[model samples]
Target: MTENLPFIEITDIIQSLANKRSTGTLELSRDGEPTTYLFFREGMIQHLKAPRSQVILGKALYQLNLIDEADYELTLSDYAQTGRRYGEVLAELGLVSEEGLRQALSFQAREDLQNVLTWKQVQTRFHGSSQPLSDVFSESDLEFELQMGGMSLLMEAARREDEWSLVREHIPHEDDVLRLSAPGAIKAEDLEVRITLLIDGYRSAYEIADAAPCNTLECLHQLAELVREGKLVTLEPLELIELGHEAELDDDHEKALKLYQLARSRGQDGFDLRRRIARAHHMLGHKQEALERWLEVAERCAEAERADLAIATLKEVIELYPTDLHLRQRLVPLLVANAAKADAALQLRNLIALAETNGESPQLLTDLMNQLLELDPSDRPTLKALATLHREEGDGVLAMGRLDELATLEVEADRLEEAILAYREILEIDPENLNARLRLAESYAGLGSTDDAVAEYRGLADILYNSGLIANSINWPFLIRVYESIVELEPSSTPAWEWLAKAYIENNQRDLAISRYLGMAQSLRPTPGEPPSPALISPLARVVELDPTRLEVCYELAHTYLALEMRVEAGRTLRQLAEEALRQEDVPKARSAYQEAIEIDPFDLVSRRGMAALHELQGDLDLAFGIWLLCAELCQRVGLLSEGRSDARRALAISASDPRALKVSAALEALAEEPQAAAALLLRYAEIMHERENSGLALEAIAQARRLDPARVARHPLLSLLSTGNTPRSGAPLR
Candidate 1:
């Protein structure tokens, strides 16, 4: 199907054909351009041909200095005479090697495809064929034919088009002249530098494009980039005049002077132009005729309601005649009435600086400060000067208030260092200001001034700690910084050390946390022959409580608890250590941990079970079975029937003939609503117990089985004979 380029972009069409694995000759053409044919084999681009252009393989080779002009001419002559392919002739004559010819042809094909891809407006059609056609060069001759895929071509072309658009923005007209502004700004080997050397003041962009070493589009794109980067300047006809007029209108006299100099080269000399030029010089602080011209222009601009332009015209005059107080008087009211706060502030600051130099009255300075404040309430420099002025006027409260406002504004603006200075000024007025001190500390920390932050935090800690206001609160992050700084300053302080250890844990510094915790433990250790403080137990225990998986930390906690003679805590810590070890499958470590727990609390059944489980994992069935039996018995004594059943199953797994395990299993079975299975298990258990000379227990087991299914027991010959002499009731004890 035929497709329009705009509706489906050329890249999308190419991608679609590739995805469909279409094999055919795809023809692309644009109006007024020769048709280009692309041959595809199994969706991969095999070859491409375009109407002959100067950028063909032979010319490319010559341009790249790979083949001499003589060789190129000779090869062409040979091809014309023999009617052979150009690359084949080049290969046959050894002007270029087979590989070199293939490479050149590949480059030629890619360049042809790239040229086609840049066609913004084109028509496309695919001509399907059942059989592929043979071209000038066989596949064997050009084994390295361009394999540029659809996606790669799309990306490259899109990138070039985007860059071309940006370049066009800078060099919009082909008639624009480009000249180098900064010859030394770019490297000598840079493409921009080479392009810049080609630019002369008289050559238009179109002429430069024709003379470029590469393709016309690429050369134009490079020239545009150079213009945009300010390395090159585009000089269109009358641009200087337009710029000069613009500067003159904006009252930028300095810029106007520069523009007018270039504009004058175009023969723009007239009385009115010379007069404006003189006025611009005068506004730049020049003399005599310039000064007269500037005064006239300033008045004319003012009458035209262009106050900004008039003010610009007068600023230079005021600089040349600083003693001209009348000129200053004229500019000040215009500045204020125009609502030009920035310009007014500058003029007022200058006036104040001049007055202060001349020893002007304090009231005059106060008035200037008030004017600056009215212009911009949050102006930092103005507020700073106002604070100093208010303090000198014996208004300390007002001065401190201004400093506080300045600090707040600075903080909100993310000007951390500026806020720090403002807060320092506030503290200077009231050294005991807690809020200012705290803000200063926070700002220091925000700016990564760690040592300064630490100092401020230590000072705040002293104040808060002395007031008894330092307690655990939701503001733990702030308190953490305070205590951390305190510990750094007073490493031996017990409270600070304790709190810092907790802080480290809270901050997720696992390594530092363990170290700090150890330090606290050592500091809280009692002297020889003295009982450790009960308070020391909590921090030591906290280490394990924070991360029970830290087996080493848990071990240390247990040892410390033992040293403190806190037996119960010691046992608990060891049990936690053993549980953590078992969870990690560290059998040897678990064994040791459990053994220690048993030493601390010999009746710790959890530890005993852990040891048994460890033994079971090590394949020691006898030991495992013994421990499981003991656990089962203890659970049964405690009325933990489910746990007893679980342990009994473990023992039965080790030895199916064990009477105790069989009895527990059978009872559990009965509870589970499987009387038939329970009775069979009990009958087997009674047999085992009787064989072991445990007749009473055996009879008890048999009676339990009978209670489960009396009829089934009566039919079983062996069980009936065993119970015949006893004739025991369901509730009777065999013994």
Candidate 2:
């Protein structure tokens, strides 16, 4: 809520000392209707819940302090929970003259939206010690901070001439199409005026936004939310933007080249324009030309003193450009040098999600982060990135420093355990960091530590409990594990037996983990909010599916079905879990998630990639390999190749080769194994190259040598003799 905070100021907060925390809302619009939005850094507008009407919107805003004191509190007492609009609230109170209510209505119509937050408009009246803004709230609530800082931003932005008011609801949106209230409410008797704008039609959305000080974002977000909710009915645009700079060409390459020429000659031939043309060049069988064009865009953007723009354009170029040792050697570190301020966090969020979505190379992550760290100086993210890079590069101890700082700041910032592992990492260094030792114990317990994980849970428990604290949230799973361990050690603690039973149910192990749940179920005891356990589901269902619920067991069910492509069964199982969550009041979100039985397999890759696991489990390598091959192929087709490669290599490691993979690789032209087939394919390629003299003699020679020694060929012995039959091949005569 500070005035005129520049983008640089936001970055300053991003780079601030002592973790200056604020939840950001890029104020999209305040003109349309009184609505708020939640947009992630990934450029996704997740939810757009709006007010029921303008009067209700104004009332909320008045209460939050956009209105003068007299207007806000006067009608406040007369407000009814089940009542209608604010103008009516005023009528009931009789504080405002009829003229005043009409005046309010007039103002409401001209103003499109009012974003409101409670914390910003008023300070806490509670008397106590001062605390960090974040510490004043419950662990479960983000509202305190939102009300304080976020709320004012909403109000200020709402009062803006054209932006949509940003509002926060107690409940996050579960529906794709959320209901937002318009700013003006008429009496129910006034049927014509009572009609709220639909805001669903694109034309309607634009008109609403245009009514006052408008931010395109509010409209965009509403559209995004509608699209997410299945509420958005997309109509084909009457005027689709077409390529008009140049006429269509005979082929893709000609089209790309012609487009590039046209842009350079006529269009907005800046970085983005040229970059787009360069990308087309790559796709249209002109890779070198594409690279050159991208380089040209980068050079131009750089010379124009638009370094940030240059960085973005260059990154795009890097993504499209063919990666090579020489190019990557010069390119990777340079990308770091050119990356813009605050772009790391933004890029990481966008790229990781994109990488996840598109199944792009994870090497992209490594490269981007590494450059970010190297280029940026002492920035927290940069420092942390350095730490992650070290750990990823097998320098765990080295990473400990960065992880430690991150953990401290993260914990101080109330980030939970997202960074605490770094604190535990210090253990490997000090082996006696008693403070870190205690923190590590807490961390392990937080991670659902088993009894055998470490022997210090009791110590941690004793310390916290004796000191009159909550004892690390009394994690029932960890307690069960501890009790189970005690049972193993002493074998007959009645307390252990009783606690284990209770813990079993809390830990979601109904039938097997504790037979006592079933025993308790038959007792027909009401367990708090739950129905008498026996009637919850059939006792028959419990008895029907009782096996040790190993991680593998959970996965095997999901994986086997997926391996067979049983979408209905997969979706059914997923839906049940989702429905269970829904019953728990976890709203159905638009994102793919697991409900009762998670059909979404975050851990299924393990079962599919049985590398050492297959060996260790006394399972068949051939079967595991078959499984991995199938999963890899399926995952690859779905653009989950990183998942595929991890599994594929694990499977490949079992026997060092798979001709089928080679064939598949041969078909896709990306797999780098089974050199005999690959080499044979290359030989054929070389002959074509030599006959056509593709590019030049240098290209033909390169292809010939490549058949002998293809670069980055996966380590397979056959690749060694991959040349023409010039050397003795296993049993073939030496030439």
| TM-scores for candidates 1 onward, in order | 0.33, 0.22
**TM-score, cand. 2 vs. native:** 0.22
Question: What's the lDDT for candidate 1?
Answer: 0.73
| lDDT per residue (tens digit) for residues 42-124 in model 2 | 22211222244333434433433345546665545445554555666655656566555544443442232232332132211
Give the poorly placed runs of model 1, Cα more than 4 Å off: 1-490, 505-508, 545-549, 562-568, 582-586, 664-678, 690-699, 715-717, 723-735
Report the lDDT tens digits of candidate 1 across residue range 56-173.
6675565455687688787678777987766676766777876676667766666677778767677887777533345533454345556767777777778777866876799765
- Going through the candidates in order, what is the number of backbone clashes in each? 0, 25
Report lDDT (CA) for all predictions. Answer: 0.73, 0.44
